[model samples]
Target: MHDEPLPPGQDGQESPGADQARSGTSLTDDLVALLEDGKTYLEAEAAYQKSRAGFVADKGKWGIVHGLAAFALVHIALIGLVVGVVIALSRFLTIWGATAAVTGVLLLGGYLFARSAIRHFKEAGASFGDDSP
Candidate 1:
């Protein structure tokens, strides 16, 4: 066979048609095996993707739950601190007086913050409008 001239599409290696003609293996068999391998690969990929998505979704749910829990904890702590402050102040003043004092302090803080904000805005505006070199 090596000494003889190679037949059409029969260069040293056997062709698909030659294999089918000489044995039980055929083009259909090869195609079926390829298709089965592709199906298996696709199924594995799909399963992995679904598993990843489920894992991410569970993490997202846990994150939201934990975030909300933390926010509620902080809020409760703030309220507790305010109550504690009022109770401590009540030793020297009436309940209403203590509450008023706290309110006054909060108002003063708010006013100072507002005044500082206004000053910053005015300074920024002046810089923007200044034409001097």
Candidate 2:
């Protein structure tokens, strides 16, 4: 009978795991490598999800901070407008007339600002619409 070289991992030849014999790729080696790669992939996916969640939470906090800052700025501007109108009206009108005119102007300004703020809130998607969260 013609003596042929025995296939790897058979007869006297050591198995793939013996001496870390990785000369040729074997089924056992491939399976082990595949499992290791899968484990690595899952670990990476978990880390990505954790990082994404933190990023979204940070963005929400920043949005809230910015909204509060804008609110304060708008109030400051309104106070300035009130002072300017009062000063300007005192130049021509009597005290009572100026007061009445300023009251009317203040009321109008308040209404306008309220309307504008509501519109802005809606535009910024702060208003709950038909789309449910």
Best-fitting candidate, measured by TM-score? 2
Q: List the RMSD of every prediction in angstroms.
A: 8.9, 9.1
Instruction: Please write out the lDDT profile of model 2 over residues 1-133, one tens digit for every residue.
Output: 9899866666768864765555566779889999999999999999999999999999999999999999999999988897777788888987677778989977898999999998998888855567765
TM values, all candidates: 0.48, 0.49
Candidate 1: tens digits of C-alpha lDDT, residues 55-122: 99999999999999999999999888878888899999999999999879878999999999999999
Look at candidate 2 and tell me the lDDT of residue 86.
77
Q: Model 2 clash pairs?
A: none
The window of 10 residues in a row where model 1 has the poorest summed lDDT is: 7-16
User: For model 1, how big is the CA root-mean-square deviation?
Assistant: 8.9
Question: Looking at candidate 2, what is the lDDT of residue 5?
Answer: 81
Residue 101 error, candidate 2, Å: 2.5
